[model samples]
Target: MLYRMVTPEHICPFGLKSLDLLHRQGFDVEDHQFKSRAETDAFMASEHVDTTPQIFIAGNRVGGYDDLRRYFHQPVADPNATSYQPVVAVFATALAMALAGTWATTGTLISVRSGEWFVAFSMCILAILKLQNLETFSNMFLGYDLFAQRVVRYAYVYPFGEAVSGVLMIAGGLFKWIAIPIALFIGGIGAISVFKAVYIDRRELKCACVGGSSKVPLGFVSLTENLMMVGMATWMAVR
Candidate 1:
């Protein structure tokens, strides 16, 4: 088999490892570093290469990185040999549930306030808990300011908005004047969150859902998980 390895600048550890591993496997590999898209195009034209890490086993184009991984690791007849499970869906669902539950419970508690002082006390407790979680998420995804800025922004803003919405929902449920608008607004934010999850997944971006037990990747399954949350939130609001 002849392997024509085309790669961008060695910017990540994974790229370097891939190159080394391919060479050690005793394939007739040619390495080309392309600094720009134009260079890549020219190289591809000259070599009749149609993809990165193009593997030709007896003059047949196998595919890209993922394909190469499967070819080397799995049997030729196993259709599902290369498939791997991703943790994104589970993580996204858990986080969304925790956030939504906090909102629902706090709102319910506020609606059934025992006294003036108790309402203030309960709100204060809820605010502190929400803020702490938000800050944790911000630090996890934002890394004090380099990448995943959107995740950080969402983390910081979402909790505060939830708190405010919770309060409004509670007030509305008790007084019967503000319930519909507040619920609608909360539902809107949930829908927006679902959209954001989808965008991140389609872009193959990393998620910044922080904390000791929350490490998840952004992927298609995660986006679907968020959509479930969106459906629930919308239903809750309407009810």
Candidate 2:
């Protein structure tokens, strides 16, 4: 019996745990890590395999992780019984970005009468929290190998950007024109980041958004979020 495991670096906790269980079961297992999706698909095609963690018992494909787990347990007849859903952490990220954009854009409209200072302070705090969430996501997606160098730089930049935008938001309450452009710039960057996460990266891993619910895709929600920012930026730029 040959147990083959194919997983991306730093993204497959369940797969790893399954592999460990297999090892304890005395099966000959070989683990392979792929950097990109193309490599993984090519290897799977060559091996005549369909799913990840493909197990071959005397050269017969047994199935994937769930299959193996069921085989070992044997309370169930089918080896391939499991519910493995793709993690959706992007929605939370989109929500955070959307909130930041809304807060920045509407700062001028919020009156200075009743709890305005508190509201501005809350926006600042939320902006910082959102920035922290983005930093966590950067670390997760880039991994430790490249995160320290590349991710950290962006991490620092984004929080500072958030701070600047927060200040501009406060200022907008006093002088609308001054803060509008600054808020637009910050929101524009946020939109770009969301676009990259959704259209470019395809939300394969978990997003590290700070607040709100986690586990949602970056496709519709992120694209919409970014579009809102872009629209806000364009409006501010024109005005």
Candidate 3:
């Protein structure tokens, strides 16, 4: 038996998770859903419980989602654990898109332009993530970014600059004069900032590269991103 809240306003996510788990474990579950907050609260009060999605197997209470996971010997996620998943996902997607687009347009996957497209695509995607919530990204960026800390407004303008640089770079280097400088300036400053915060200052902080809410550690990945921009800019300038 499984008792979970399924109100009109909000369906409890853990309840769905619990149901899926039970099914996967080959258990036939009798679902008992509370359709309103009042009923859920009253049941909770009567049972001396604090949360929903309570599971019962063969008349034995298996508790909530995490508790059920333990019963099944499954690993539970740590909320505070540092994860590179988001950044990896973004970069991987960008690389795939860059390769696919290059092949579709040029009839080949390997070319000098392939690398350029990869970096440009990465920049645009990263900028899009940061631009989703400028205020949040700005606040988090100010924590360790030297330029943003000093200028304040630079944090907000940073994403737009990245987007512009990326778009111009993708336009076949025709606007190299404009794109190169922006990429160099932003990338140079970012590299230094990340280096100081992570290597020199020995500060442990979250990266704002993906977004403010991401838990990506402020270190190598961030530095590499900046370095890619700098290298791309320098190459474009000289070529």
Highest lDDT scorer: 3
Q: Which ten contiguous residues of candidate 3 have the minimum total lDDT?
A: 169-178
Model 2 alpha-carbon drift over 4 Å, by segment: 1-126, 131-137, 141-152, 173-186, 209-216
Candidate 1: tens digits of C-alpha lDDT, residues 132-237: 6665555643432222354446556644544454465435344323433433453354445435644643443344322212434444433443343334334445
Query: What do the candidate models score in CA lDDT, each in turn?
Result: 0.45, 0.49, 0.94
Which residue ranges in model 3 land beyond 4 Å of their true spot? none
Query: How well does model 1 score by local distance difference test?
Result: 0.45
- Against the true structure, candidate 2 has what lDDT? 0.49
Highest-TM-score candidate:
3
User: What residue pairs clash in candidate 2, if any at all?
Assistant: 67-79, 88-215, 88-216
As a whole number from 0 to 100, the lDDT of residue 23 in candidate 3 is 97
